[model samples]
Target: MGTIYRGGSRGALAGLRRPHLHPVPSVADRLNAERHELAGAACTAADPEVFFDGTQDATDVAKRICGGCPVRARCLWLALEHGEAFGIFGGLTADERRRLRRKGVSAA
Candidate 1:
C-alpha cells in the first residue's frame, strides 16, 4: 500500500481547501440596500445630463419627467436642504431653486 501522510503534498492541501467565498454584506451594504428600494424612481432611469442641461429645452424635458416622479417631494426637499449648487432637481432648475431659497420657500 502507498504511504499516506497527514499533511500530505501541496495538491492534497488544495484538495482539502474550499473555494474563496464572497464576504458577507457589511453595514454599508445594508444601508445601500435600503436606499436602493427607491431605485424605481422616475428620475433614476432618465439621462443624467437631462438634469444638468444648460439649454431651456433640455431643462424642460427634465422638469416634465420630475413632474410625474412619485418621490419628487423628497427629492426637492433634499436639494433645498443641501443648497444644491447646480442641475435640475425635483423638477426645479438651479435658478429656480435659488429663487425659492431667496424667497425662503419650502421645497414641499
Candidate 2:
C-alpha cells in the first residue's frame, strides 16, 4: 500500500515554492541616492536666512550655491512636489518654481 500524505504536508509544499531573490543595489547607486538628498546638499551647510531672503543680494548668494549643485534638478522637483512656499531651490526662488508649475514645466 502507498503511504498517505496529509493536506498540511510541509515537505511537499517546501519543494514547490521557489526562493525569492532580490537584487542588491550597487555602491554607486546608493551613493547617487545619498547624493541627491537634502543632507548631502551644498545648501545644507548654508545659512537658512539666505534661502528665504527677499533681497537681491541674498537671493544671488543662494543661487550661486545652487548653480553648481549636482542634485539641483532633484532639489527643484522635491520643492515643487512639496509646494515649498519659501527659499531658493535649484537656483530658483519659491516664486520662480511656482511660475514653472503654472506653466506646466517640471524641474526636468
Candidate 3:
C-alpha cells in the first residue's frame, strides 16, 4: 500500500524567499508616487487653467518644467497607464500627453 499527501506549511515557507516574492509596482502606483513627489515640490497650481493655458505653445512650458523634474518618466508612465484625460503629470499638460499617447496606441 502507498499513501500520497499534498505539501503543507513547509512548502509555503520554502517559496517565501523566492525572488518573485515582491512584485514590481504597476505603472499606476509609480505614477502616483511621482505625482506625490511633484506635488511635494510645491509646483502645483490652484487652478488647472494656469497650467494648461489652452494653447500649443503653453504646453511646451509644462514640458520644460517636467524635464527638470526628477520623476518625469514615472509620471508619464502613469499618465499613459491610467489614461488620464486631464491635468498635468510629469510637467506635461493633460491634452498634450494625451494626444501623444493616442497616437502611440493608434500606431501600435
The candidate maximizing lDDT is: 2
How well is each residue in 12-92 modelled by candidate 3, as lDDT tens digits? 111112212223232223233334445443334322332435466656665666667666666566555555555466576
lDDT of the candidates, in the order given: 0.56, 0.57, 0.46
lDDT of 3: 0.46
Best by TM-score: 1
What is every candidate's alpha-carbon RMSD to the true fold? 19.0, 18.8, 15.7
Q: How many residue pairs clash per model?
A: 0, 0, 0
lDDT of 1 by residue, 51-91 (tens): 65569889889889888888777767766765556666678
Task: For candidate 2, write residues 9-45 as lDDT tens digits.
Answer: 2321121112111112222222233333555577656
Using TM-score as the yardstick, the better of models 1 and 2 is: 1
Candidate 2 regions off by >4 Å? Answer: 1-39
* C-alpha lDDT of residue 79 in model 2: 62
lDDT of 1: 0.56
TM match of model 2 to true structure? 0.60
